[model samples]
Target: MAALNLTPSDTSTFMLMGIPGLEAAHIWISIPFSMFYMISLLGNFMVLFVVGKEQTLHQPMYLLICMLALTDIGTSTSIVPKALCIFWLNLKGITVCACLTQMFLLHTVTAMHSAILVTMAFDRYIAICNPLRYATVLTNVRIAKLGLVGLIRAILFVLPLPLLLTRLPFCANRIILHNPFCDHMAVLKLSCGDTTFDGIYGLVVSFIIIGSDLMLIALSYGLIIRAVLRISSKTAHQKPLNTCTAHICVILISYTPFLFTALTYRFGQGIAPHVHIILADLNFLVPPMLNPIIYGVKTKELRDKVGKYTSRR
Candidate 1:
């Protein structure tokens, strides 16, 4: 392995190896990857369409669903297309600028996705624990404001990542990224310069943003459960709990794989690179692909609206 001793420049490009040990199986692996991406696109678009076209679906919860759908689309779109190109077309060259841009979009949208889930948990909390104040608390204007704040927060935290990477010197010989997409850590690992600050900054950002969001979500659900348990009738318990079912499913799908991938990357020294890469890919693919399905199946109003629209079409 010859080291070219290169720095980040306008002309520097990185080669993406689709999967470290599965180059021979790249085309076969792409079959399911493409399917997941397509399902994510179609399902999330359906959610957006149903939410937008129906006046009855224009509540705070459904509006949040719209935001989730948009983020889901953004998340999948940011990584999957490039991945498919790497897998199928064997076109792996990515310029530094393009790689940084993709990294930014991927991280930003992912952060926003986490924020939206926290907001949804808050919605559930208000609707259950403080039913009387739900409407006033989560008005359309306020939701819009929340979305804006989430976007700004995501940008603030993730904007420095690519910028920080620009300062690190990348080795020309080490430009081939083993993963499908340009991840912050993967790119950082390629740097020959000191990465202590970059690594610490990334870990801090993840803990601050994702860690706090998870804690808030847990608190919201805890309160919701407490409120539900105090109900005297078993039948009444079903309704409020039912409303949270899809959200719980979405959260599980989104976070479980994410935590696994992150942990594997940091601590699983014995784990194979392909295993880590596959889990990381699934973390982005599974949640978006399943979110709309979960909501559609669990929420009666959304299901009815979707059914009606499809029947009419």
Candidate 2:
């Protein structure tokens, strides 16, 4: 069915509601998001620096961590700054191309993240389950292959979603995006033509592309846990588990809300506009906050290393 663009009737649009109940809720939202933007920049840049500087961490695991941190940086930077600008400044107006570009980069990077998780899962699986094969499996050649695969897979799957979105016809009401960012479903809702194709294409991307990536990650962890159990020494088992723990936790937190948002849009409450808004914030804000804490704080090597690296005169 064709999605109706929001006319004057459907919009009590609290998109730029300023604040929830306070005097300047706009400033309130902008403040926290601004703080988050800074933290994301600092945390991820520290991660990149440590990984780059310390030759001891020149292994595949740290390399992947660097890449993951970079992805988090991209993910947060892609959406949050524009959102803060719209909220704090009076820059509420985004063009069709800008909106499409924002949505495209957001999803493209997100897709890369999911694929990276899949690759990291394999890395953990090999390091634990097939110790002898770990080096061969995740060699620089193979890592290069995985990186190329992730880049290509993300572009191949998610680029179409936004390209399809641009084909949508907008009526007179192309003004404010319901969410601060040019969210895919939110933008699709503005389409003057049938949104069925966009919705179907997005659903396929979600379930087949991202969902499949999650499943493979889970399977890798399954084999890993099995391998850990088969090991005789408890400490050895825990070592591998310890490394995988942060990644697994980040993956779960990052993904669950996104899938919930998708479900809420397609099958759950018909009020996608509000649910979408809340989930959009969570999807953007929560991960940037969570990634540093969950991933960085886990290992003493990273903690002490970053601590010393930053504390330098």
lDDT for each of the candidates? 0.89, 0.74
Cα lDDT tens digits for candidate 2, 138-178: 87667767877898888888888778866766655554445
TM-score of each: 0.94, 0.87
Q: Give me the displacement of residue 219 in model 2, in angstroms.
A: 0.8
The candidate maximizing lDDT is 1
Q: Return model 2's CA RMSD, one decimal.
A: 5.1
96-139 per-residue lDDT for model 1 (tens digits): 88889999999999999999999999999999999999889999
Off by over 4 Å in 1: 1-11
CA deviation > 4 Å runs, candidate 2: 1-24, 232-236, 263-276
